[model samples]
Target: MMESAFTRPVARPLVVFDGDCAFCTASIDRIRDRIRPDVDFAPWQRLDLTALGLTEEQVENAVQWIGSDGGRASGARAGAMLLRRAARPWRLLGTVMLIPPFSWLAAVVYCLIAHNRHRLPGGTLACAFPGPNRV
Candidate 1:
């Protein structure tokens, strides 16, 4: 639903990230470096999430990935989807997530990070909202 610079009709997944969070930005940068050149990455904050039927609270709570058919994945599912799109070794890593124990572990980790992101060192006060000081 979010618009991106690289949308293709050929059916590839898109990653929607928190652009304002330094940690999220860094993670996305790493993912971009590893993924196939065609995968799409966009800032959820900059895009019109409401148009996408996603609330700001939802965007702030977790990373999201929209599959080719418009299905949505969140948290660890989103992470695995991203790795699967990266090809080969990364795909292998993503596949490991399908295992029950590992999948649960990944989900727990993702939830922890997502819930406490704002308290993390590089995550504090990193919002796209304009303050009163802005002209």
Candidate 2:
């Protein structure tokens, strides 16, 4: 099948997320609208995971970052990668996040947030989960 507007490869980095979650959607919107990073974001539901070298289980859990070179990062590392591409302050923080204790802390924090996102502001009932959210 021919690639439509949504399925083609991107020259820029791509951020894969779960569109079914309101919190996730809000977060991405805020960042894209306000921060204006040089990245492309797509809800995994509308894109082909296999073409993007992603898995349903991968995107269903946390946000994902796919660099133009096909490198991938998820969760906090993905966030860090995004911030690193942003202007000034965020870039600084992203760089720091790649460091020792900060990276570890960011990872832990990301997991916590990802699991509890359904309870966060802007979250919806469809995003709810009872047990562990990770796969």
Candidate 3:
């Protein structure tokens, strides 16, 4: 496995994902296997979305990263935070992804992946987002 700061409990940030999505779960599993961050994973269904100031639609659309200080990052920002916590090379890559043009592209890619996830490997028809809603 890769050795990194995240291998230990650096901050124990929470990664809230869609439990209803097989694709999302599989992706998370793959990330765990590769990075092994000392992060806590929880399904959106099992968490208090209201307490987190989140709605079902929000989580259904993208992954969420809740920092220890209560800072929140969603979509590509969340992905970047997770990747940046991985080993050195990955951290550098993550940093690169956060730059202007790359960041914009990453956000677009993240949205595309999320929207079409149900059609991807390990995903079912139910894995699609339920659309937006008012909080």
Q: Pick the candidate with the highest lDDT.
A: 2
Task: Highest TM-score: give the candidate number.
Answer: 2
The TM-score values for the models, in the order shown, are 0.76, 0.88, 0.85
- Residue 78 CA error for candidate 1 (Å)? 0.5
Clashing pairs in 2: none
- For model 1, give the 10-residue run with minimal summed lDDT: 1-10
Better of 2 and 3 by TM-score: 2
Query: Candidate 2 — what's its lDDT?
Result: 0.85
- lDDT on C-alpha atoms for all candidate structures: 0.73, 0.85, 0.81
Quickly count the clashes in candidate 1: 0
lDDT of 3: 0.81
lDDT of 2 by residue, 18-53 (tens): 889999999999999877888888888887677777
Model 1, 1-135: lDDT tens digits are: 345333334266677888888878877786677566346778886776765657766676778887777878888988887788766888888889867899999999888887666666566666333344755
lDDT, model 1, position 107: 95
Residue-level lDDT for 125 in candidate 1: 62
Question: What tens digits encode model 3's per-residue C-alpha lDDT throughout 90-132?
Answer: 7887798889999999999998998899999999988977745
lDDT for position 121 in model 3: 99
Q: Residue 72 CA error for candidate 2 (Å)?
A: 0.7
